[model samples]
Target: MEVAYRIHLTAILSVTCFLLKQGLPFRGNDESSNSLNKGNFLELLDWYSLRNEEVWKTVNQNAPGNNQLTSPKIQKELANACAMEITRVIVDDIGDNYFSLMVDEARDASIKQQMRVVL
Candidate 1:
């Protein structure tokens, strides 16, 4: 992959991980379509741009006309890949080892059922 593409992908993965750690949705209602939304990946990119102009510059350099990689569909696909890679690493670390896991189920304030697994 091109360096700019790699950098962009890395930035996307980093932001996705941050969102996952915070238990926040990567895409909001306003971002359901192709348009950019403030609280989602677009905001993350803007944050990066502000935090470090050089890094954002590198990503923008290789980005075609626009940053198509920042689209919601692309972001979701990249997030899934990131999750899979993380799970694979965790599973590999547990290979040939016995580990105890606890699953807790509860309803959140919105009355949605949620399950958390602790290992």
Candidate 2:
């Protein structure tokens, strides 16, 4: 049984290698292997951390576009899609009340693009 299994495996491998050697591109070479992986998922800046007050203030000052409690364009874009709201306490802001930010996760009206809002 084991001998038969090895024979079958060797046959498949030989066929594959033969096809690849014939320039069929069935096997991955060095460059092909390097380009196959898409890489890791990126951590977004908007929600990674609210840890430092300076960082929070910098984002608010530079991009007031993200300063509001919600993204109107986002809400409108998600007018027909399904979504949810996420709230988190941020110690990254320099102010009283320790005001927390409201973050919303919603998709475009067609459920294409998902967006977030923070206040």
Largest lDDT belongs to which candidate? 1
lDDT of 2 at 67: 33
Per-residue lDDT tens digits for candidate 2, residues 8-112, read: 333333433343345333222322223553111001122321443443444334334443322334323332121121112233344465555677777778987
lDDT of 2 at 60: 35
Each prediction's TM-score against the native? 0.73, 0.23
lDDT at residue 91 of model 2 (Cα atoms)? 33
Q: Candidate 1, after superposition: displacement of residue 95 in Å?
A: 1.0
lDDT of 1: 0.75
How much is 63 displaced in model 1, in angstroms? Answer: 1.8
Q: Assess candidate 2 and give its lDDT.
A: 0.35
- List model 1 lDDT by residue over 1-119, tens digit each: 47767677677778878887787877666754355675666677668867876657765554675665777787788778878998899999999899999999999999999999999
